[model samples]
Target chain A: MILPYYIIIPLLAAFLISLIAGKKDNWAVILSVIATTALLVLSLFSFISMKDETVTYSMSAWSLPYGIVLVQDALTSFILVMVSIISFTSLIFSIQYIRHLSMDWKYYSLFMLLVTGMNGVIITGDFFNLYVFMEIALFSAFALVAYGSRAEEFEAAFKYAVMGSVSSFLILAGIAVTYSATSTLTMAKVAEVLPTNDQKVIFWIGALFMAGFGLKAAAMPFHAWLPDAHSSAPAPISSMLSGVLIKALGIYVLIRIFYNVFNAPEIFTKIFLVLGTISIIIGVFLAIGQWDMKRLLAYHSISQIGYILLGMGIATPLGILGAVFHLFNHAIFKSLLFYNAGSVEMALGTRDLRKMGNLMKILPTTSQTSLIASLSISGIPPFNGFFSKLIIIIAALQAGLPWYAVFAIIGSLLTLASFMKVQRYGFKGETTVESVENKVGWRMNTAMIILAVLCIATSLMVVPGIQEVTLDPVVKVIADKTEYIQLVLGGMNGN
Target chain B: MQQNDGMTLIVKTVTRISVWMILLYGIYIIFHGHLSPGGGFAGGVIIALALLNVLLAFGRKFTSEWLNISFLHDLESASATLFLVIGILGISLGGAFLANFMNKGELFALLSAGTILTLNIFIGIKVGMSLFLVVWVLAGSKIVKGE
Candidate 1:
C-alpha cells in the first residue's frame, strides 16, 4: 500500500498541479511543497519501520508472474529516502529560483513527475515498469533542461535527448532479449530463470545494461552528455540531477541488476573496476579544467560517482558499504554545492570562477555551505565524504588492488586540488563583488543550510552502532546476491 | 489554396464530412477498446487527427475561433487526473491498486471490463486533448517556425 503511494502521490500532484494551478503559480508551489513533504515523511517512515523486511505490492491483485510488483526493501527504501529528501529541498529551492526565471506552474508539474518517475523506478519490481518510469523522468528532464530556452539550453537538451534515446533503445533491446531468454518481466522471476539458461545471454544482458545504465549514470566512457545537460539545467534542477536522478536511474539499477540479479559475475566486476578507475582519474582531470562553476560541479558529479562505482566494483563487504554510504553522502554535499553555484549565479549573474570574487561576506550562507561541501567532496576528515572515500580506498587496498587504490588516492588528491581552486577563485578571490542583482532569498538559503547540515549529519551513518541499522542492512541486501530473489519472491503480500 | 485558408474548397468540403466521421469512429474505437484491438491510445490519436483535419482544411483561424486552448489544456489535465484516480479508486474500493473492483459485465457486452472501460475513456480524452494541444502550440510557436 505504501509502496504504491510513493508513485501515486507525486503523479497525482503533477496532474493536479497542472489542473488547478493558474498563471500565478502560488498553488503550484504550495502543492509541490506539500507533495514532496508528504513523500519525504512517508519514505522516512518506511525506512525506519521496515528496516530489513521486504514488502511487495502486486498491482490489481495479480500474483508474481503476471502482475507488476512494487517492492519496498532496504535498498529501495534507502534510495527512496535519498530521492525524497533531495526533492523536498530542491522544491523549496525552486520556489524562489524558478520564480526569478518565470512564475510558471509547468516547472512544478514537471518536477513532481520527475519525482514520480524516480520513485516508480525505485519501487517497481518489474523491468518494463522501470523502463516506463525512466522514460517519464527523462521526458520531464528534457523539458526542464530546455525551460530556460537559451540557445545553449536547447543545444544541451538536444544532445541529452539523443544520448538518452540511444541508451533507452539499447535497454529496450536488452529487455527484449532478457524476456525472450527468461520468459518473464518480473525481476525476481527473471533472476530465478536467468541462471538456468545459457550464460551467453547473461553476458549480453549485462553488457547492454552496463552500457545503457552506464550512459544514464554518466560513466566516463558514456559521460559526454552529462556536463552540458547537468550544467545547462536551471539550478535547483541541476542539484536534483546531480544529487539523485543519476543515482536512482543509473547507479541503483546498476547495483540491483549486477549484484542482486546477476550476482556480480567476474567479467562485469572487472568491467566495472576498469570503468570506475578510469572515471575516477579522467572525471577529476576533466573537472579540474572547468572554469564554469556549474560545469565544474557537473564534472565533479562524474568524478564523485566514480568513487561509488569503484566501491561497487571492489565488491567486498567494506567496498559495498563504502559505495552505499558514499552514495548517500554525495547526494547531500553535491546538492549543497549546486545550491552554492546556483546562489552565486543568482546573486552575481555569472558561473565563471574568474567572474566571481570575495562572496564570503555577501553570500555568507552559500559560501559557508560551499566550504562544507567542498571539504566534504575533497575527503576532509570528520565529514561524510572522507569516511566513505577512505573506506573505498582502504577496501581497494585490502582487496589486493593497490594500483587501483593508488589511482583512487590520486583522484582524491586531484579532487582536493580542484575544489581548492574553486574555493580560492570562486568564493574567496581578492576582488570584492559589490552589487547583488538579486539577493539569495531565505528559502534558497534554508534549502542550502538543510543540505549543509546533512553533509555532517549523514556521516553518522557509518558510525558502528548506527551503521548496523541503516547502512549495514542495505549492504547486506547488495552483498548477499541470491537473497534478493528469495526476499522479493517470498514477500508478495499485496494490498 | 490561399495562405492560412488551408486546402482548396473541394478539399475543405470533403474534410468537413470526413472529420466528423473520424471523430465518431474514434469514440467508437475507444469505447470498444476493452474488447477490441484499437485501444484508448490509438482511438485518441484518431480523435486528434479529426481536429487536425479541420486545421488543415479550414485553417488555424477557424479552429482557434471554434475551440478554447485553455479549455483543451484543462480537459487534458482533468482526464489524466481522472485516469489515475480511477486506478487508486479501485484500491480504495477494496482489492489492489487498479483492481477491477466493479462487477465484470456480460462477455462481449459494450460495458464489459469494469475499470478498463472507464480508464480507456479517460485516457482517450487525455491523449486526444494533449495531441491537439501539442499540434496547436507547435503550429503557433515562433521558435518552431524558426523565425
Candidate 2:
C-alpha cells in the first residue's frame, strides 16, 4: 500500500499543482515540498522494513506476466533513498532559486513531474513500464530546461530533446524486438525463457538499449549533449540532473536490465568497461580545459559516472560493492558540487572562472562546502570517494586488469589538477574583480552545507560492519539474478 | 468560414484517418505479441503517431484546445503513476517487481491475457501523450524564433 503511494503521491501533486499554479506560486512550492518529503519518509521506512525481506506487489491484483508488477528489494530500497534525498534537497534549493522567474509555477510544477517520473522508474517492475517512466522523466526535463527560453537554453533544450527522443525510439525498437523474440514483456519472464546461446536478435536489442541509455547516462561516445544541457539549466535543476537523474534513469536501468534481465554476456561487460574507461579519461581531460564552472562540473559528472560503471562492470565482489558505494557517494558530492557552483553564480553574476576570484572571504560557507566536495571528488583521504575508488582499483588489480587501475589513478590526479585550478582562480586568488558583486542567500548556503555534511556522513557506510548490514545485500542482488526470479516466483506462490 | 478552412479540414481528416490506421495496426501487434510478435512499445509508437497526426493537422491552437495540453499533461502524469501503482501491487502481494500471472486462470482469452494487456495500454497512453505534447509544443507559436 505504501509502495504505490511513493510514486502516486508525487504524480498527483504535480498534476494538482500545475492546475492551480497559475493562481498561486506558494501553493505549488508547498505541495512540491510535501510530496518530496513524503517520498523521503516512505523510502526511509521501506529501507528499514525490507532490510531482510523481498516484497512484490501485483497491480490491480492481477497475476504475474499477465498483470504489471512492482518489486522492492534491497537494491530498490537503496536507490529509493538516493532519489528522495537528492530530490528533497533540490526542491528546497528551488524555493529560493525560482523566485525571480516569470514562470515560477511552471518551474515548480515541472520539477515535481520530473521527480514523479524518476520515482516511477526506480520502483516499477516491468520493462515497457520502464520505458514509459523514462519518457515522463525526459519530457519534464526537456520542458524544464527550456523554461527560461533564452537562446542558449532553447538551443540546448532542443539538442537534448532530439537526442533523447532518438534514444527513446531506439529503446522502443529494442523492446519491440525483444518482445518478438521472447514473446513476453515481464522482465522475470524474459530471464526465465532466455536462450543460453547468444542470439543475433538479442545482441541488436542489447546494443540499442546500451546506446539509448548511454546517451542518457552521458557515457563517452554518447555524451555530447550533457555539457550544454547541464550548463544551460537553472542552478537547482543542474544539481538534480547531475546528481541523481542520470544515474537513476541511465546507469540504474543499464544494470537492472542487462545484468538481471538479459543476463549480460562477457562481451557486454567488456563493452561497458571500455566505455567507462573512455568516459573517465576523456571527461576529465575536457573538464580541465573548460573556463565555465557548470560545464567543468558537467564534464566531471561524466567522469564520476565512469567510475561507477567501471566498478559495476568489473563484476567482482569488491568491484560491485565499490560501484554501489561510489554511486551513493557521487550522488552526495556531485549534488553538493553543483549547489556550490550555483551559489558562486548567484553571488558573482557569472560562472566564468577567469572573471572571478577570492570567494573564500566573501562567501565562506559556499567556499568551504565547495572545497569539501572538490576533495571528496578528487579522492582525498577521509572522504567517501577514497574508499570506493580504492575498492574499485583493488578489484581491477585482482581481476588482472592493471590498466584500469592505472586509468583510475590518472583520472584522480587529473581531477585534482582541475579542482586546484578552480581553487586558485575562483576562491584563493587576489585577482578579484572590483565590479564583481556578492549576495549570498541563506537558502543557497543552507542547501550546500547540508549536502556537504551528507557527503562526509555517508562515508560511514564504507566501514566494514556497517557495510555488512546495509550495502552487502544490495550488492548481492546484482551478483545473483537467479535469486531475484526465484524469490519473486516463490513469493507469488506463497502469497 | 471559407474555402480555405474547408480545404484545411479535409487535409486534417485524411491525416487523422491514416494515423488511426497506423495505431490500430500497432495495437494488433501488441495483442498478438504473446504467441507471435510486437508488444507495448511498438503499439505505443503507433498510438503516438495518431496523436502526432492530430497535432500536425489541427495546428497548435486547435490541438491544444482539443487534446487540452494541460489535460494531456495530467494524463501523462497519471499513466506513469498508474504504471507504478500497478507494479507496487506485486510488492504488496509479496512478489517481485512485475511478477505477473499469479492465478493462471487461462492464457488466450481477452480478459485472461493478464497484465500484458494492461501494461500495453498504459505504455501506449504514456508514449502517445508525451510524444504528442512535445511535437505540439515545438510546433506551437509559444516557440519564439530567437529562443
Candidate 3:
C-alpha cells in the first residue's frame, strides 16, 4: 500500500545526497527540495481521503495482533501535511542558511533524516514503532544541534543529548511496562483491553510518558534543554524543531496514548491543566528576559505549547478541537518566526537582540514577516493564532475552568509583550552602518517570504465553513477515541 | 587522543557482543509476546543492541563499509514500510487497522503469532540498525567532521 514512502524517500535522499554531494552543493539542495515537495503532495492527498476512511497496511500479508501495522486517519494525515510543509520551507531556507557552513552534504543529510523521523512519528500506529522514530528524530537533532560545534553549541548539544537520553530511556521503560501489562504493543489492542480501574503500573506508565514526552515537548520544568538547543541550532532547524517536531514527537503522541490507548483517568486532565498553566506563566516570564532572538522564541514555544495542552486537558469536544486548531496555527507562525530569526542571523551573523537594531528599512521583507508572525502568535485579530487562542479560552470557560482562561489570556499578552520587545530592538531601530553593509541571501529571503505567506494563508483553516471540512475530522479523532480505534482495527480486518 | 599503554578497556568490542545478545533475546521476547510477556519494543531493543555490538567491534571504518550508516539507515526506513503494509493488509482483509491475530492459526506456535512475529522482526531490524548507527556516528564523530 506504499505506507512507507515517507520514511523511504528521505532515507534515500540522505544517502544520495551524502554520496554525490561533494563540493557541488546544489545536488543536495535539489534532492531535499524534491523529497519535501513530494511529501507535501502526499500529505495533501492523504488529507483529502482521510476524512471518511481509515487506511491500514499490513506487512507480508499478515493481519494485526501478529504483524506490523500503519494506520492513517484524519489526525495522522493532517499532521503529515504540517510536517511536510515545514520541512519543505526549511529545506528551501537551508539553501542560503548553510551557505557558509562546512560539510554541506552532511548537514543536508541530517536535515532530511530528521524530516524522515518526524514523518514516521506522525504516520506510525504501533507503539514500538513510535519509539524507534522518536530515536531517529532525537539522534538527528543531536547531530544538528552540534553542527556548528562552537564551544557553546557543543555544550548545548551535549546537554540536549543527555536529557534526551533520559527521556528516551523513560519512554523505553514505559513501553516495556505497558507491554508487560497488556501483552500487546499495538494501540488498537491496548484500547480494547485496557482496564477501567487503573493500577499502580498504569500510573507508572502515565508518569513515565509524561516525563519522557513532556521533555521532548519542552513542558515546564522538563524544558531546561529547549532554550539552549533552539538558540544554538541553525534558524531553519530551530524552526522545524520548535514548529513541528515537538508537536509530532511529544504532544501528539502524548495525546494519542492518553486518549486512546491508556484511556487515562480524570487525574490526567487535572495534571495536564496544572502543567499547562505553570508552563504558560513561567515560559512567558522567562521569555521576557531573553536577549537572544531564537531563545526568546524558544521560551514562547513553551508558553504556546501550554495553551495546546490546556485546551486538550479540558477533554471536551470544543477543547480538543481548539487544541488541534492551536497546534496547526502554532506550527505555521512559530516556523515563520524561526525563519525570520534565520534571516536575521544570515545577514548579521548574530541572534543577540542587543546587537540587532533598527533594520526595518534594510530588510523590509524580513521586518514585515516578523511583524505578521509576531502579531499572529500574540493573538492579534484576523490571523490564525487569534482564533485558536480564542477557541481555547472559550473552551476553558465552557469547561468551568475560568482561571485557565485567565492564564491563557495573560500568557497571550506576555507573548505579545515579549515579541514587542523583539520588534522594537531587532527590527524597529536604526540600522547601523556596519549592519546596513551586510547582504542577505536570496534563498533566505525567498524561504521567509513563502513561510510568511503561509502564516497569512493558514488563517483560512479557522474560517467557519472551511474548518468544518479540513479541521473537524481531526478533532473528531480526538473526541471519539473509541470510534478511532474501532475504525482502524475494523478497517484492518476489512469489516 | 589519549592512548593507553597496556590492558586498556575497549568499550566498543565488549559492547558489540552484548548488543547481539540483546538482539536475539529481543526476538525471543517479541515472538513470545502474546502467550507470555514482552512485545515488539523490548524485543526490538535486544535485536538492535546486537547489531550495535557488531558495529562497535568493527570500528567506524569496517562498520561504515559493512553496516554503512547510510545502508543501515535504509533498513530502518524499510522496516517501517513493512510495518505499514501489514496494517493496510488488515484493512483490505476486512478487519480494522492493526487488527492482529485475526486469523488465529495456532495459539502458541511461532507461526501462530502471525502479525506479532512480523512486527517483531521489522522493529528488530529498524531499531537495531538505527541505534547502531546512532552509537557509531557518536563514537566516530571525528571521522564524520568535514568542511
Best by DockQ: 1
lDDT of 1 by residue, A70-174 (tens): 888999999999999999999999889988998899999999999999999889989999999999999999999999988899999999999999999989999
Task: Give the DockQ-based CAPRI class for model 2.
Answer: incorrect
Clashes of each: 0, 24, 55
Candidate 1 residues lying further than 4 Å off, grouped into runs, are A493-495, B1-4, B144-147
DockQ for every model comes to 0.83, 0.13, 0.08
Q: Give the fraction of native contacts in model 3.
A: 0.00
Q: Per-residue lDDT for A116-182 in model 3, tens only?
A: 8888887777889889988989999999988887878888899999999999999999999888888
lDDT of 1 by residue, B1-147 (tens): 344487788888899789889999999999999888988999999999999998878888888877887888999999999988888987899468888878788998999888889999988999999999899889987754452
Better of 1 and 3 by lDDT: 1
Worst lDDT run of 10 residues, candidate 1 chain A, spans: A486-495
TM-score of every model? 0.98, 0.82, 0.81
Tens digits of per-residue lDDT, candidate 2, A1-495, equal 566676678877776676566578889988898889999999998887778577876766667868777778888899889989988988887777667446467787788779878888888788898889889899999988887778899889999999999989989998898888888887777777766535877688889999999988999999999999999898889888998889999988888888777776777888888999999999999999999999999999999999988987898878889999999899989888888887788778889888778787788898999999999999998888888889999999999999999999999999999999888887776666544354667877788888889878888987889888789988988888556777676676666
The interface root mean square deviation of candidate 1 comes to 1.0
Task: Name every residue pair that clashes in candidate 1.
Answer: none
In candidate 1, residue A154 scores what lDDT? 92
lDDT by residue (tens digit), candidate 2, B49-68? 87777656665556555666
